[model samples]
Target chain A: METQLQLLNTQGFKHTIRRLCYELIENHNTFENSIIIGLQPRGVYLSSRIVKELKEITGLSNLVNGKLDTTFYRDDFRRRSNPLIPNQTEIDFIIEDKKVILIDDVLYTGRTIRAGLDAMQAFGRPKKVELLVLIDRRYSRHLPIQPDYVGRVVDTITSDSIKVKWDEIDGQDEVLMFTDNVEKI
Target chain B: MSALSVRHLLGIKEIQASDIDLIFSTANTFKEVINRPIKKTPSLRDTTIANLFFENSTRTKLSFELAEKRLSADVINFAASSSSVSKGETLTDTVNNILAMKVDMVVMRHPYAGAAKFLSRQVKATIINAGDGAHEHPTQALLDAFSIHEKLGSIKGCNIAIIGDILHSRVALSNIFCLQKLGANVMVCGPPTLLPKYINELGVRVETNLKKALEWCDVANMLRIQLERQDIKYFPSLREYIMLYGLNMPMLESLKKEILIMHPGPINRGVEITSEVADSHQSIILNQVENGVAVRMAVMYLLAGAKQ
Candidate 1:
């Protein structure tokens, strides 16, 4: 337990520094002017996590909000079994004049991340936009884009997948990289 | 939870006897939950469930979503107009992507028949079919049975009249099959065109006169005549429909015994049945709605959370 917390506190600081560095360069060194938008469920929770780390270290308290849903931005909606249901889109920070750092858990096929982008557009335009993820599967990049900061990279086969279990949602915090239930722990 | 298990639940026709019995009885556990102060449970804790509805529905979707939330699951919402459906995503692909995200289960209501069942076949997630086109609404039947079982103490020997748009109602078909299985005399009444010829094969007695069906039944379940389904000429007019078969106060008063009034709503308030009659002591429409969530939760846990 102590080790996990220690790793999170230390590595989380490193992750925060990296996240803030991109914002500083893109926004021309404006410490007081940036925001974070989290995707629904995990993505939103992840942004809040990173925001905590970033705020504690930088003491700037960058604005944080949650992207409601990207279900509507799916590439194939015509034959949808059931289309996206509208939920609460929370944005405490004004995206109109601030740099937006979109945060999520995994970025695969770039679809969900794209959906997050579309959801951000509905909120308001931002001066700059960047991406962050806990794990980059390093595959399924349908769009010609990539995350600005990544925690881990696993060269994954299409057959197997990774499942990140956090206590907030799954009753535990474990960054697992599994392939067909086989582990590389 | 296995990928090779039953696919998306579009209806109950393709289900087996054991699974059906399990669902019906599992729904019985919630009889207490339904009557409690805070009718909720934490069985689905930390689970995120999405309700993707391509069609407009109030009772079914609300009840199903409530069922998920009551089980302590996180809920996601979707609609047809602003969702990916308008963006050209195929149903299977959308389901596959969402499945990829690992949402625990999906409770869906769609206009297409066999959608829920089709989804169940492809993915490993649990499927609960809210309603599909005119094909079926299994949870509706389960809840209607649950309510009937509550009132009559048993499902046997009760005569139930399913009156309204028989042609376009999957509810009528499911009720007939399920009610008859539990020994209820199933009477289907509607316009000749609205009643299919194959209904007789299901052992349901068909009549064009709503009054005739009403006189002989213990429960009268009215069906909504979909305005969209009428474009191809199933009726003369809404005026003609209300005059001929609509349930009004006088009709309720004339019935010798108080037969239960039921409608799978978004009710056409004054068209098929009057609003006053729908809210009367004899009407179980709201009870039907209230029971839907418990019944759906029961249906879901029975299929997905059943013991191996």
Candidate 2:
């Protein structure tokens, strides 16, 4: 059986989110030209929390927030057995000449971020694109992608998995890392 | 959850109910994407697809090519008339040559039944059956069901009547399979000779009277009479068939309820359905055509994504 290693509990997760929110406000002080896009599935949960915190701090009610699904753009689609389940992408406004902040829960292989870059092209060309994540698995990069804003960075090997659990979706806020020797079955 | 169980989409018979639901859900996203200002995505940029059409098709050919381009896959078009298949090249050899060029998938429309299925076995590339003679056209049926689900809110329990040319139509066969699988009540309406043998065994009601069929169905899918596929006239005459089976304004109004009209085009305007009904507000033929691209995109995306 695999033993769970808790990297961040409820308090730590909340503190990290608040810190990320403040850092976002420091760089993106105004909401006129900036849009926040969360990568679909888990990324949307974390991004929404940050967006909620930003709204509470800055009193900006109209900060453009959308979800981007990268299922169709993944490189490892052919290697998987299950048919890809696609999530909804709801971007009501245009992204032309706008700053795009892409938010996700964890950054490991950097393949999801690359796919996000490709999916973003379907909307409009952004003036600038930036990546944000709660957990950055250090030294495990498959693509040359680095996050602009990171909450925590941890060193991990290829056989490890980092899982982020949210309170809204997962019934609790916690980050866990699992070693691959213990089978998930 | 995966969208499909099978690697290649050869027919509706090979697909499960959940697979159709997944395809529809994926197509819903593509539908939104196609309506945007920047419609193209770089999702399949690294993949390559080939359109190998052994039979003549204007809409399916163009629709598949457009879907491929929208997904950003490298696309090549090959028709039998211009290819080495005309010079006595075998189907396997022709497809193998295309596969040799690093083609990852093929959307084929052939004149023989089970052609796409046969090609799927001979080659490793994913195969999407555009149309294979009188066998199946899975994507067309998907788009048809999708259009219905879009208009009617859901396909389950909806009364759908497929009218005309059941014997020689792959669309009719595929649609019957798809609709039944999705919990829709299906009825096949055509002339006695035009109706297929053992169609009742497929668990669909068969009706020869056009008026009764129209009165019973919530949606009427009028199929075009396939002049190309007909070796001999199945019915007595075109005029007689139109008088008995043709859908027009007066007949539609006689139904007393707003029944949705659909057709897998190119429509024989005055034959299976009149221009008035085809152009009416109830007609979702154009929406069916629009959904074609989205459905094809979903199928190609799923197949390519499941390549391993």
Candidate 3:
């Protein structure tokens, strides 16, 4: 059996997004020299929402945004039982010599972020790179990667899981934490 | 959420329709990857691929090599004419020797049909059949179908006609299987002698008249005449075959509808199609060649991931 707990509801999710957007605007004033790249699969939802919130706040209609898929850059190729399926990478704009803000839904293991760093080199060498995440699972860092902008920091064990659900994908905007419990007879 | 249904890409016939869909979708990503300035990925950095050609090839070999390199896979090439094949060493012996060096995958083209299948049973490495006699050329078929799918937006219910030598063409065989699996209505057009005897069993419509086939289909994939494979004359001569079956500008313009033109290369300039038609706006021959690399890359990537 498993137990589910709702960490952030719809109202709280909206507030967190607004705060993250403000923090981004505080760092990147005009964002003329900066770009937002959404990591593909689940991260795309968080990135797109962040981009929308940032655009609404700054009124920058021409904000450069792209989606990147890092399946190919993962170090675990041929190491897993199931094959890794890749998603579409729609980065039409160049990231050359610009500050790239990579957005994802959750931060865990940090391997995906590492792969994203490697995948970004294909587009061009960015002047600077930063990572933003909606949920930061503390004590789960496998690689030496820390989010530049984190929405919420939650301490978790190795076996625990964190899932950030968005209205665009999961039909609801909330953060859920699940813990598996095995009962003895 | 999906992996290839089969471990090895032996032929289009051996895979399910979902496999083709997966390959096409993966190729779409690789297409973007190849267009980038870097044009390379470190997906297969630790994997090693051995390209063994028991038959002579130019484009398929080069395309596989390029795909392997682009994916960061260390590649080794073997030409039968220059290797132990000339020294009367058996196929199993040669491939086994290569496997002893920790070769992970084998991309092979052989003059005999079922060579790849045979090697797969004899060894443990992944086998990708480049082409085997007149049996199948899976990757070529994949790229051809991908090009059509890209241009037309969808492949289902599309009227696709394959023109020219069907009897000796592995491209034709593989294309028939691939297109049919994708839900496309396929028709083979060629001289009676050139069409395979058991082609009707494949459930494809046989059209002897070239003009009628062109008029009936939304896309026409013109196959090259394999003179080297044919020991006996299937038709009277190249000139007569061209006059009857050749795809010229006049023939294309007379169709009353815009149909995509394609060829699995090494084109017989005036024999299968005219130069004007080959270079026409409707021709996607070069696109087929370009997609070849991406499609191969996708296949290698998926197969590599499926490896145990």
Candidate 4:
């Protein structure tokens, strides 16, 4: 058996997201030259939501956004038991010299962000790049990555896992924390 | 996290439908990767692949090499003609000698069928059968199916016709198995002599008339006649073969409906398919070649992570 906790409910989740959007606008100003790039799989959900919220706030319809998958760029390719399946990276517009914001649902070990930075080099050299996450697992980073805009911060041990559920995908918007069985971990 | 069911990609017949789906889905991601400006991934940075061609090849060898390089895998090329195989070194000994260099995978093309399978049994490295005799060219079939699926949205319920040299072409055998597994109706069109004796046993329709096959299929994959592999005369003359089995622009224009044209390539030019037809907008031969790298990359990527 495992212990579980509900960190944020639907109302709190909505308020948190709106707060993050306002923080983004504060930093990005008009976001005219800035683009939002969501990491693949889970990240796309949060990033898409953020993109929509940003558009609603700024009234800018042409804010560029794309999804990037880091499976090929991941450092742990063959380290795990099962093979890593890659998702589609669908960035149609040019990212050269543009300020890019990378978004994910949860920032855990920070390795994904490192991989995303490497993967972004393939598109073109961005003028600047920043990281944003709905939940940041503080002190659990394996790499030197810090999020520019964070919704919530929770200090976690190695065995603790965090999951962000969205209404669009998981039937509800909530943040859950699970303390896994030590042996299983 | 999904991996390939088999350690080696020996043949299309050896893999399941789910494996094909896995390869195609993985290839979808790789296709996008290759189209990028950088066009290189570091997934296989620590791995080394050995390209062992015991038979003559131009496209398959180069394509495998390019795929390996694009994946950032250290690659070494070996031809049987230049290697110690000509000096009577056994298959086991030659591969073992290369495996001694710590090669993680082997992409092989040999004159005998099941050579890749035999190598997998004899060695400890992942094996990819580029082409083994007239048996299976798994990657070629995969890329052909992928190109068709790309153009038509889905391969299921699509009419795909494999034409020419069915008996001596590995591409035809693999294509038949792959297309059938993907729910595509397959019809093999070739001369009576060129068609295999047990082709009907595989459950694919056999047609001797090219026009009938073309009219029936949504896509026609034109195969090259293997003149080099013909120990005895399969057809009387090239001119006669062209009249009966060749794909020409005039023949294509005669069809009431437009059909997609494809070739495994190293084309015989006017012999199997004319330059006009090969270079036409309907022909996806070049796209097939481009998809070959991505499909091969996907195969290598998946197999590289397979449980040992």
- The most accurate candidate by TM-score is 3
If both were scored by DockQ, which would come out higher, candidate 2 or candidate 4?
4
TM-score of chain B of 1: 0.91
Candidate 2 lDDT, A43-92, residue by residue in tens: 99988998999999899999999999988777777677665667889898
Predicted structure with the largest lDDT when compared to the true one: 3
Better of 1 and 2 by DockQ: 2
The reply for model 4, stretches above 4 Å from the true place, is: A180-185
The residue-by-residue lDDT of candidate 1 on A26-47, one tens digit each, is: 5534345667777775777677
TM-score for all predictions?
0.59, 0.92, 0.98, 0.97
lDDT of 4 at B20: 90
Instruction: Using DockQ as the measure, name the better of candidate 1 and candidate 3.
Output: 3
Candidate 1 residue-wise lDDT, B21-95, digit = tens: 555555665544455444555445546787888888777878887787766678888787787878899988887
DockQ of each: 0.01, 0.52, 0.75, 0.71
Q: Which is better, 1 or 3, measured by TM-score?
A: 3
Show where candidate 1 strays beyond 4 Å. A1-185, B1-9, B16-21
lDDT of 2 at A112: 95
Question: After TM-score superposition, what is the CA distance of residue B253 in candidate 4 from its true location, in Å?
Answer: 1.7
Better of 2 and 3 by DockQ: 3
Tell me, by DockQ, which candidate is best: 3
**Relative to the true structure, how large is the alpha-carbon lDDT of every model?**
0.71, 0.92, 0.92, 0.92
Off by over 4 Å in 2: A81-83, A179-185
Candidate 3 per-residue lDDT, tens place, A1-185, comes to: 56777778999999998999999999999999999999998888888888888888889898899999999999888888877999999899878999999999899999999999999998888999999999998878998999999999887777677888878768999999887632310
Residues forming the 10-long window of minimal summed lDDT in candidate 1 chain B: B1-10
lDDT (Cα, tens digit) per residue for candidate 2, span B102-138: 9999999999999999999999999999999999999
